[model samples]
Structure formats: structure tokens, C-alpha cells
Target: MSVWPAYAEIRFADYGEDFDPSVERTEMERGVPKQRLLNTDVLQTIEASVQFRSAQAVEDFERWYFIDVKRIGWFSMEHPRTGEPINARFRNGRIGRLQPLNTLFRFAKRDLVIEYVRAPQ
Candidate 1:
């Protein structure tokens, strides 16, 4: 049985990496800056957005997101650009709707942001 929903129909709009800093900065003596690390035990949270171009893709994601009328828990996701599998969950419960001005291609698209953290070792 699959632990998570499959999104094979969804195509990634673009590939890129996003970095989230998890650090605390403090001023030390003489206006010097001192950095205190927080959540060092886990890898920095990776933020990424996925875009769905087709209605079918959006439908698939909507079903998955609204499954059982609850937000899905953390699941495994393979980074679209790096191909590195990381545990992640949807950053928000809702997906953003987008429509282009081109009337020739009236298809709407959706964007979903996901936040990834270090998977259990």
C-alpha cells in the first residue's frame, strides 16, 4: 500500500532550490555579532513550490490535500531538481490559483508550497 498520494500527472513548472535559515544572531561585546544556532540537530528546512498546469493535475492534488478532510502528514518527496528524497509536508492547507492573461490557453494552474526537513536517520 502506498503511504502517500501519487502525483505522476503533475508536471513541475520550474526547478530550483530554496534555503531557510534557522539561526539566531546576537550582539556580543564591542558591537560584534555572535551567532547561536537553533535546531542544529535537524537539517535546515527546505522550502519548495510545485506548480500544476493541467486541470487533471490540480484535481489530483486537491483530492490528495482534502483526503479525509484533513491535511496529510509528512511524506517522502523526491526533490524535482536535485532528485534527493526528503521528508516534507504541504506548507499550507490551500493551493494558490493562477490564470494567465492569454485567452488562447485558458487552462488554469495551481501552485503549492512544501516545506522539507531532515528525514529520520
Candidate 2:
């Protein structure tokens, strides 16, 4: 039987610093800091998602997800020919990749809903 790989749905949101940076940009027509949000506001916009990763991925995202792995998901195959268990069979295996953190962050008004579900270790 195939094992239900361990996974996690981490949800994080941040509109940068507590206060908008002094260099707050603006729209072409408005000619001012059009609109922005506080850190808490962003914390509430990011949608929840799941990512299947080895134990290593947990620490990686926890520390560098913002830059390395923006979004989160189960990629079909990370290492296809390393003599390892490849996950290329969409019919039975899994795939991993970044989710929709980009679009989610772009939205100034959205609800944050991250769902983390990992198989018991």
C-alpha cells in the first residue's frame, strides 16, 4: 500500500513592518501612498495551503519560505533519477511546489486560511 505522505499546511501573512515604510509607493493617478495594510492585516489575508516535504523542508520554510519557497504544495517529483522513490505518478504519487502566496499577498483585502495536515511521524 502507498503511504499517505506527511504534509503540512502552513499559513503566514505579513504586510511588511508594523508601519508602512516611509517610501510608501503610490498609484499613477492617485499620486500618493494609494493603499497599504498593517502586518496583522496581511496575517489575515494569506489563504491556507498544504505542502508535503521531508523533515528538512519544515525547517527550510520556517526560516526561508518567504524567499525560497513562497507558496506550498506537494510536488510530483523532486528527484526523479537519484535512485530514490520518485513521485511522478499523478495517478498514485504526489507532487510538491509553491502555492499561491504571490496572488494572496497581492490582495490587500483577503482572509487568511492556512491548513496544515501532516501524517503522524
- How well is each residue in 3-119 modelled by candidate 2, as lDDT tens digits? 222344332332111212324345776455465532322211113234424444444444443333323432332221133332221212122344443433321222223222211
Error of 1 at 77 (Å): 1.9
Instruction: Name the candidate that leads on TM-score.
Output: 1
> If scored against the real structure, what TM-score would every candidate get?
0.64, 0.19
Off by over 4 Å in 2: 1-44, 65-121
Pull out the clashing pairs in model 1: none
lDDT of each: 0.54, 0.31
**What TM-score number comes out for model 1?**
0.64
Residue 87, model 2: lDDT of: 25
In candidate 1 the C-alpha lDDT for residue 42 amounts to: 48
- For model 2, where is the 10-residue window of minimal lDDT? 86-95
